[model samples]
Target: MSQHALLNSVEHSDLKVITQAGAEYGDNLWFTPTFPQEFRAVSAYYPIFFHKDPATDTFHAVALFGFTHNDNLFLDGDHWQAGYIPLSLRRQPFLIGRQRFKEDGMDKEQRVIHIDLAHPRVSRSQGEPLFLPLGGNSDYLDHMAELLETLHLGMEDGQDFVENLKRLALLEVVTLELTLNDGSQHQMVGFYTIDEARLAQLDGETLAELNRRGHLLAIYLAIASQSRMRDLLARKNQRLGL
Candidate 1:
């Protein structure tokens, strides 16, 4: 379980986070949650798809890094091969938390930064420091705060984007099957993607509405990203020496 706590300079002044990319730093994920705002960039490098959360039965957009669990073809030694990494993956060990505060005798909730002490990237030595020697937030911490804020807002927008797609009946279940060079077969199930046929059949008014909401371009980007599945298969074959 994650041991998350509100970050404080007094208690976490010595906390350091590893900046390298590798499985040791918890980079073994095959996919990460992504949002519509990041589709253009993420679609360029990774195949974008949607998966339903079992706990909530809600669909979420994701960027695929590998075909199987515990695999990330993008990780080569300590470097990430992709030119762009999803915000969800980039903002590791830190997350936005809600804090209730009294402002002018009114209770209001504010977004604050929180850290996971048990995350693998966290360390006491040989990494980026969270605070300065004189007791102030480090440059890294400042950047993290900005990243978390962006991620929070992007996710909120993504929820509405997905809801609109569902309301329009544009999403459909998709199954991917790949055959490696060595004649081995792999099948991926329970994923959803935009139905190009239905999308093409949308009325002009609906298309105009989607375009107004900026979801039309995002939907096309997701459809175009499926071409990268071939690239992912090649990476897997190369790793297997097939």
Candidate 2:
């Protein structure tokens, strides 16, 4: 259940948001949505992949944290082991909302921050306060606002990145079979990755165009992120005490 409320200092003066990473805070997700803008940081720690939305048949980038559903290897008690957490996860319990205001005889829409009142991260005490004693936004709240703004812009860029990859046929289906240390076999499918072979065969002009669009770097980062899969497996193995 979700109860989204437009965040303001008056109604939520005592609102304290738990900022720690833990399962109780719904941080047990196996993967999180990501964008090309943060792929450099994401690819450095997690395997960057593409996920297709079955309902819309559209694609978007993701950073994988575990092999299967609801399994986040990065979650160890209250600590997130990764050096960087995807902004999608970090901005949870809050989202961008639009408000229309009259300006110069025209309606102008502006983005506003909305918080999920029913989210597990929300609390009455023992967490970061959203507003200061004087009723102004706290530093933490300002940081969240900035993060939401960045995500709002990055999501638009991600759509273009996915479309360009699709147009170039750079996404290829991939299947991974893993045998855990405890003798459990897991087969993962329905995921895709950048087709390095096809990416290399693109004409010079197309390559130049992709580079000019700042897509080539994200592509290479996604490919380079594959190496992190080994580290992920090791974490899984260690968790299993293998």
Candidate 3:
């Protein structure tokens, strides 16, 4: 269960957040939602792919971390081996929520910061403080706010990008088959990747439109990111001592 509550300095002044990368803090994820703004950084160390939700029939982007669920190849002890971490994973214990208020007799909703009180990263005496001694926002909190805003925008934009890919038929379902050094086999299905042939065949106008929307770069980045899967495979091998 999540103990989500609106963050305030007066009520949570003593709250501190653990910044280290650790499985105990819920970093043991096989993959996490990713966005185009972080694509350059994410693609450097993770394979970017698209996934379709069967219930919602909506498409979204992700950064693959391992071959199976709950397996994070990036987590080595309490340290993340990657130089760049995805925004979704980095902004843990804090979530962006909406709050309503009256502004000049007009009711409006605004994005607000909410923290999970029960998270393992939450504490009083350890790690970085959320508020200063004088009840002002700490530098860490300020940074987290900016990160959340970026992530929020990125998520929205990524949804549009995926929809455009789907409309253009630039996405192709694929299966990931791998054989381990120990003669073990693994197969993963229902993942979507760029359809290079369709992408290459797109007319000039469609290509220009994609480039104008800033999705062309992200598409290329996703294509280029497939190479990182080899590194993930290597990490798995090392983990298994194979």
Candidate 4:
């Protein structure tokens, strides 16, 4: 159960958030949603893949962190052994919420920050403060606001990015099969990858259009990130002492 509420200086001015990487703080995730804006950084460290929502049928880009659920090879003790952490994971315990109000006699919706009091990272005694002594937003809170804005805009653009990929028929199902040093077999299915053949067969006009929209680079980055799968396997092997 989560106790989420609108963040306010009056009632929750003393709130603090832990800024550490560990499974105890719920950082053990196999993947997290990502966007094209972050593809350059994300691709440098993790394999990028696509997953479709079963209920909405909408596609989302994700950064793979491990071979199985509840596993994050990048996590070592209380530290995240990665150069780049996904924004979705970084913006923990806080989420963007919509609030409706009347602006100039017209209904309008605005994004607000909501914090989960029950989050493992949430603490009142020891952690980064959310507000200053004089009731001003703390540096951490300001950073969180900026992160939320980036995430919101990136997700909006991601929807269009997925739509464009669908239009080009560049996405195809993939199955990843791996054998561990311990003689354990693992298979990952229901994920999508860029179809290199289809991408190559696109007409010049379409290619130019994709380039103009800055999506061609993102597509290539996603494709190139697949090489990191080997790195993940190596991490797993190291963990297993094999």
Whole-model lDDT per candidate = 0.93, 0.93, 0.93, 0.94
lDDT of 1 by residue, 209-242 (tens): 9999899999999999999999999999999998
Each prediction's total of clashing residue pairs, residues at least 3 apart in sequence or on different chains, is 0, 0, 0, 0
Off by over 4 Å in 2: none
**Runs with alpha carbons beyond 4 Å of true place in candidate 4:** none
The C-alpha stretches of model 3 lying farther than 4 A from their native spots are: none
What TM-score fits each model? 0.98, 0.96, 0.97, 0.97
Error of 2 at 103 (Å): 0.8
Query: Tens digits of per-residue lDDT for model 3 on 11-125?
Result: 8989999999999999999989898878999998999988888999888899999988889999988999989999998999999999999999999999999999999999998
Candidate with the larger lDDT of 1 and 4: 4
lDDT by residue for model 2 (102-209), tens: 999998999999999999999997789999998789999999999999998998999999999999999999998888878888988989999889998999999999
User: Tens digits of per-residue lDDT for model 4 on 105-165?
Assistant: 9999999999999999999998999999998999899999999999999999888989999
For candidate 1, the TM-score is: 0.98
State how far residue 54 of model 2 sits from its true place (Å).
2.0
lDDT of 4 at 223: 98
Pitting candidate 1 against candidate 4, the one with the higher TM-score is 1
Best by TM-score, which number? Answer: 1
